[model samples]
Target: MSTMIFSRTDETPGIHGHTRDCTGAKGSSTLAKLGKGDIVVVDAPDINRTLAQKLIDAHVGGVVNTGAFTTGNVPNFGPQMLLDADITLVENVDPELPGKVKNGKKGRLNDGKVYYGDRSIGQGEVLDEETARTRFLDAREALIDHMEALSGNTAEFVSTEAPLLIDGLGIPDLDVDMDDRKVLVVSPDPQLEEKLKSLRYFIREYDPVMIGVDQAVDELIGHGYRPAVIIGDPDLISSDNLRSGAAVILPADPDGHAAGLERIQDLGVGAMTFPAATGDATDLALLLAEYHGASMVVNLGPTLDLDRVFDTAAAPGTPSAMLSRLRVGNRLVDSTAVAELYRVSRSGGGWLWAILGILAAVVVIVLIAGLSGSDGFVDNLIDSWNNIALKFQDLFS
Candidate 1:
């Protein structure tokens, strides 16, 4: 239990999720100002109480919850624990809504009763759940639109193309022969921490490059691994990490905190700054590693699958960044591979038996389906054949 009090002036729609999950465009920006050890009191009572408890567990200080804990269906114990722990709890500041007073920023409830922060000032009203969700979705759509708009723009084309020049040189793949290439990716969010940790074994074995995007550097440093490459603009990642000896690749545009080429020069280290092409630089860093001939680039916190892409792309610049990397043949490591490798490496007889059982089951299924004369069975067989055909297309197309 940490004991301190801090205030958030901005009550952005997504701040609750951001503070809890530690991702999202505005959340990342705010989180960069606070670290693992810092404490801040929040004004929003509508925040998920579970998230509040998580923050307390992580040693966050007392919160001055403005709205009554019960107003938004958020947990009661979340605030109760703070009171139980003797953490400062302030409630019912009516003249000045608890959120506004705690945030120390003036805001107004919109016609729809949602909080809309002034982008320039970084302050907004606290929105109700329905409005917040709607705004969040809109923000996502806007980001996707931005990514699409920037994908082929000259700035993106130039930045993305400069690296591809190496491809034309016919350079042999650079052997990532360094046995010491072990990497640890970090994120402050527990869910993200679990996600990254899931791939720990694969990261350890096929270690090629250690790359951290934004606050991931803090997470990595906490785990005793200094990143070789730190991607993203200086907005979210502390200037201290950027100044540290790690190679800093800045973003191109201001939207995604795209590091400027000049900042790369100022860093006074071997650095690469890409034009803020349409995607996040984390994706760029991974592709850049692959393009530069890393034998096996094992991403610790890299985004994989369509769902993750959609989630990450909801942020302003991620959509274009992801789309651009996809064009460059950047390989998104499969989560299944992570599970398989871990099982094979960690499990013994049980894994072997499980594999044998799966193979036997597959064989039996194919034989039975082949012999079954019913139309349903035949339809299933044709669907399987089409799936195989699609896989072949993916492999060769």
Candidate 2:
């Protein structure tokens, strides 16, 4: 898919930037380490929006991927995103090409030929936006085939994990009380930050058993609400927050290695391990809530997309994710619904109840602090609710 090259518009069609090894295989983990203007050398064929957004956020200058940009089997949405951001994208390079370019070394691109300090390291086809868009349209035709394969895999997973879903075989007990209560599970999704701004009021009202996966837990803690459980690695959260008495559950490796156990032990924090979960940790978090007898669960993350089964970085529609959703059924409430519920309650004639709820919450916080020696927890709850009240007063008055 050769197209016109305007990577650099000066005289020659080329770009010069520092080279960095960043395999798309490692997903966002590698992208998070990159700095602005560094050229990423990656190995992702079906790059999705999440990966591209990470590169955009890191302000990378270009991408050198060994895999063909689009093979018609899956969509390569990231290529267009990169090209739109004015980042040069060269693909189908030799498999060994990424290794020759050392990180922090100035690498130059001239008409799809990669050079490491004036020496040609490899040659590949560079893509323009028009060509990438054409390929992406063609790739959509193949998504049904991919969906069929994923459906087969989903059937297998349901057959394998049915016992856990039905009988609660591997679900663990937690210090947090969840039975008959609503559960709020937050994950690292694009909408998480903005959605939480309004949903914090829902938190104030429901006081759902809070579960946070990945660094999204920090968002909740920053809003003055500590998660009752943290379902990612201990290192994923701040050290101070990690010690704040949340039930920490790290996902074990598929081969039985306890992932993040050592880090939790090093931090001297109490933690447990969920069996290696399929897809994202957020899936397991939702399943955990469902099996723990949560009356309802509110999921704060990317809505599932079955077409993205191949995206390892939080593909919303992985087969395992499908299974988790099927297991949770209607109990898994979307954040949008939660938002609507909050709006309705705010508009209805219920100001007296809201005031009474806040007053009762304060009394409960004081009693819990006095009886349980959780002074810090009480203080945070008070501060968070007080902030909510001040905002409400400002908005109405």
Candidate 3:
């Protein structure tokens, strides 16, 4: 038996995605937190791939939620990760079931019902490993269907949003010289993060402009750099970073209601809003960079992957994104290919080479002087060389 705990869904007033409400206090601030051998009851309609994968990573005993635990509407790696981890997942449980599960109560899942303190809180369908795998395959099939539908309508959508490219003409008070500059747009993806870490050599060599999308600003901070520009919904960004002087870009709807407009304006920060052209904030960031004459855009963590399209917000935009990529072409590089293209030896140039060059010249001059036939020159050179060798020996010692 494992300890049981309850958490609100993303729809809950204050719960962020896959939040943990630790410290025993329940409010908008408390995220749901649990550990190994603990059963977590959540109110979300579906266990999203990210959360499901996280539970598996945390080694949780089991999960009880109101919805199924596939990739939701798109194809993603979450379901596959969960299946591989072999964590217990039960879904379609009643929302009120968590309440009936008293705190500190011991619970166990048998068949489809969760029993706590000899009482059955609710019943659900257990998602075995094979079922999870099947769901992932189905989600990927749906993504293919979505891409096909979008490919069918791409010419239409591109025609509609093509004029919107002019909308990226400018932000009210921000100025950036994007011509011929490499721009790195970061999104909050674990794989992207790891890829970025591995490409530090390339990053140092090029020093591309860093753009953070929403919560990815924090990820940028974690990597020892601050974003030059932060784009997307303002609510997802921390006030401290927003005030750190990065330009903000918002995605606007046709109705003129822009995501994060009020908050950004309330903070008195000027932001440029472009009519929503793509699905997720990262896509919007890439569009902004490309439209503004960026010479090159390197994306870390794009949702263009088949597994990535499973996110609800990303699924619809999958088609639009395809068109956007076609427009950007080789100018847009994902993190995966950065190493092969930009990675090079650090000794190519810079101060390190300058110092080595100076030392080499000094050694050459000394050798030339030593080769002189003059007895006095040879004597002085021998003494100086002996002194230098002694010094070198002392230094090494």
Candidate 4:
């Protein structure tokens, strides 16, 4: 997420705004209909950073969640995220608040109580910046427990899927050649459009095999990058984009559900399935890229922080995210790392090219002046160059 200026002051924040029901946010695209400064009510326990980022982007005046904002099960940075942005976060409100509070109804949140047009709707634990910070620190103390759980789950995953992980069984052979190519697997995210815009330089230079994970194609196409391959639920993608010639890699878990297979069949489009797929679409894409001999598999918009992993992860079943990363090993690079290194390299490299071009132009000009056998030609050229330099300096300054 990008850095944002905290808009709060040293005052008891009493926020009043219209309500927007976001209880089943995962089941629908609610952000499109959501207006700026609308008070959002969601039912997310241990709200992930990704969803928090989206809410922050939506410019919601406040949030009323039916579940614990942090839950203390994992070190979730979401509560603090909302607090940091000066957005009032009232957590653990009534579960049936969504039913009681209709969308577009005016509500005021203050001192842990929610009032819908002067009538008290419900009350919950209101989180301020300081309280959230303390909660987050306490949550971090449970990291050891979280790590143990992750290790145990990953062990269980490996033991059950030994044939797939150890023997490379069920990995599909695709017509797309991946030998020595840098495969870029992009997942759908609220921050994806902004992130991709920044990485335009890297994409242009490497021209990596663009793999869109589910609705990520929307952002990729928005940024003018056509996906070379799509791996996810085809239902999430537009019918028009699906027919855009990109090969589809559908997730077919061993449980027998092939996501979007029916849709693809209806469209008369062919697809390759990653049998017994596990994690999310992005994980399967990583596994495919790594298995197909991709030199480097760059995952866009996923954090290296394990604490935030599962919250945003396409995990549990499709492909196991933890194991998939383990399988890829050193080849897997997050977008942040790529951005940091590539940006530094180009910042210096650009000046070198500019200097070389300037030197070459000077030599040609001097050679012309000498060949012309005119001292006045050289003087005229110098005056013209000085004038151009002053104009450029003026423009920039």
Candidate 5:
């Protein structure tokens, strides 16, 4: 059984099992460290449980969730799974209790439990079932408040560039478009690279303009697609790609480290340098593409979730650019969707695997229903199965 020790703001005083070390790296690295003992601290219900499950599946000992077991939205499925696996589960550290006694800052919230620094806090007294229920609600409210605060800051930063974005719009030229052009967007991560490769097939079929956002230029280069435009502050992307004849967009801020602007000027590639403000330039690039005449812009490995937004914030700018693209409607295609659409091939092996999966699923359902002696379950399964079969048959026939 895995042991998960965490602290919550809702617990009573003097709990020893609710806290964990978290001072060095407060996020993923801290979580990774906890994996050594199979003991993990999960304090925020607003934290993506999908991410938590990914950690747990990697053999994390157990999760000590601070909030409710299940608040319906970001369900506690991962924690529940940890419980079902007989992992140690505890919650509700005293919210008002002093957590880490760091540098004379002795009084702090229960969230202070998961630090790698000296000093320690523990889970408070375990509640009876009814008190646990009430504390769960309190935890849920605390989580909500945290989420709202984070979201507000994100929204503020995203909105900072709205005016410039609005002013920069123009009618897009459609005639110079090349049909079915393949483009690749590069990122440092292998997962992102895989996602881009999957999305490329669809974009290739369409033959639209391929715009590489930042390091995605390398991704395109590796896959044999020439990037038409490289958009970003030059710090993350190589100045070489810009100097090597690709068009570059430089952000306006000197601190934005709009590198390669001079090279772009020397190379005479059409470049636009915008003020380096809070919003993302990737969003600017998408908007620019639309203004300049891209029929459809497909994003490869763009940030799409809250956690990603947080991660991306560690980069130079706000993710307002991606958020702006969201408001752009059908003009932007999320690369993840494209990847899913193109992941399976129409060739022999692909069709064979899909058929086998469906057949195996059908067999399992039939066997399970038969063993349960539930006519309703079997009947519903058959009815749904028949409807699917009939639709396919009709289409083919």
Candidate 6:
């Protein structure tokens, strides 16, 4: 019902920047703060798919962004996600309008104009599904042009000093039984709940090792699963989860400090710090599992959507995440397929139940024959049943 501006600039062109309705936080953080019926005025040059997805999940009324959705800025699928969610996304809005809005405040968008506290300040162009489609295609083409510049060389995505950074970066020395074990790596993605439900049987049957990444710890506990290890920034994870007896792993900052270590230190629980890597917490968790020699890794809520190229300094195509997967190889199984495999395993026991049912039916028929005093008929039925059983056994043999 109201508008909030996301900006980093001192002042938007033609509009005042120092408004109470504006947020200087990044787009994803801004979306996290805003909710349903909120209007997000993105003053940044581009929004990533992660933030776009947040806006969609928030069920926001609309997004009035002043920045262009170029290949370098916007995530590839950001525009499509907004369109599919039917969230009104107005690109190339008047830059000045965003600054007019307040931070943590409400405003309205109507008739190509933004209104804050009942006053119209600036105009914006509304992007429909068709327009979003055209924009996404153009962005893809531009992305290809940029990729051509790199000549498909993935080595460029990694720093030459990566080997130095990773060498001897203190990883967790905790011993985990990886022999024929199913290790479940969980992420804080929204689809995690559904995916966890599908894996319930496998979880109960295999009793796999659970590793929660960041906010995924909450999901794991909420779903009645205890994480053997929780890794990530403590700010995103709950205090209870951190104290849940799980070994904590966090990215060691350049200063050799980890954000999560401070939270768990007072509890007398120890934590291991690894050198900060390119990908987010989920990637780090996967790498940790691989390092520990997990027999099979089941990933839930992993970032599989590769259609993003935000304007931020974050690398496109997620080389670090890809590298983590390559490290794990065929041992990595998606949650959906894992659930199917578990379901099939459970169904395999159905024949035993069917045979039991047949035995019960035969007993009931024998009782009926006894009660009716039909000895001859009962004897013939028994003979025939015995013959049938023998024939079945012979067929199997």
Q: Which candidate ranks first by TM-score, i.e. highest? A: 4
The TM-score that candidate 4 achieves is 0.61
For candidate 5, lDDT tens digit of each residue in 261-330? Answer: 6666665566666553643556666666655544556666545564444342343343454455665556
Alpha-carbon TM-score of each model against the true structure? 0.39, 0.53, 0.52, 0.61, 0.49, 0.56
Runs of candidate 1 exceeding 4 Å displacement? 1-190, 238-240, 254-270, 302-304, 308-319, 325-330, 334-340, 348-397
Where does candidate 4 stray beyond 4 Å? Answer: 1-148, 277-279, 309-319, 374-397
Cα error, residue 120 of model 5, in Å, equals 24
The lDDT of each candidate is 0.49, 0.78, 0.67, 0.79, 0.53, 0.69
User: What digit string (tens of lDDT, one per residue) describes model 6 on residues 189-250?
Assistant: 77788889888888878899998888889878987889998888887887777878888888
How far off is residue 196 in model 1, in Å?
4.0
Encode model 3's per-residue lDDT on 1-397: one tens digit a residue.
Answer: 9765954232322111221322123512222345566666655443456566556766766666666665446545654565577656677877667556654455666566776434566888877877767766887787677767666666666676766544543323347666678998998886756777877887787888888987888778877877788887889888778888777777677456787777887888877875654546776777767876778899887547644444446546666677666667779988878765544444355678889999999989788767764667678688777877999999999
The TM-score, computed over Cα atoms with residue i paired to residue i, of candidate 3 is 0.52
Kindly indicate the candidate among 4 and 6 with the higher lDDT: 4
- Candidate 5 regions with alpha-carbon error over 4 angstroms: 1-162, 165-189, 254-270, 306-322, 345-397
After best superposition, candidate 6 residue 288: deviation in angstroms? 1.3
* Candidate numbers sorted by lDDT from highest down: 4, 2, 6, 3, 5, 1
Candidate 1 has its poorest 10 consecutive residues by lDDT at: 14-23
User: What local lDDT does model 1 show for residue 375?
Assistant: 64
Q: Which scores better on TM-score, 5 or 6?
A: 6
Model 5: lowest-lDDT 10 consecutive positions: 101-110
Task: Between candidates 2 and 4, name the one with more favorable TM-score.
Answer: 4
* Model 4 lDDT per residue over 1-397, tens place: 8886874332335777787888764424665567678888888888889989998998888888898887765778898888888898888887777777777876777777777655777888887778777777877776665566666777787887788877777778878888999989899777897678768889889999989999888668767888888888988998878888889888887775787899999998888887764637777788889888999999995654544553323234412766778889999998867887878998979989999999999999766654553557767677667777999999999
Across 148-210, the per-residue lDDT of candidate 1 in tens digits comes to: 654545355556555543342221233333233433333234455565666666666765467
Task: List runs of model 6 lying over 4 Å from the truth.
Answer: 1-137, 145-169, 308-317, 343-360, 363-397
Ranking the candidates on TM-score from highest down gives 4, 6, 2, 3, 5, 1
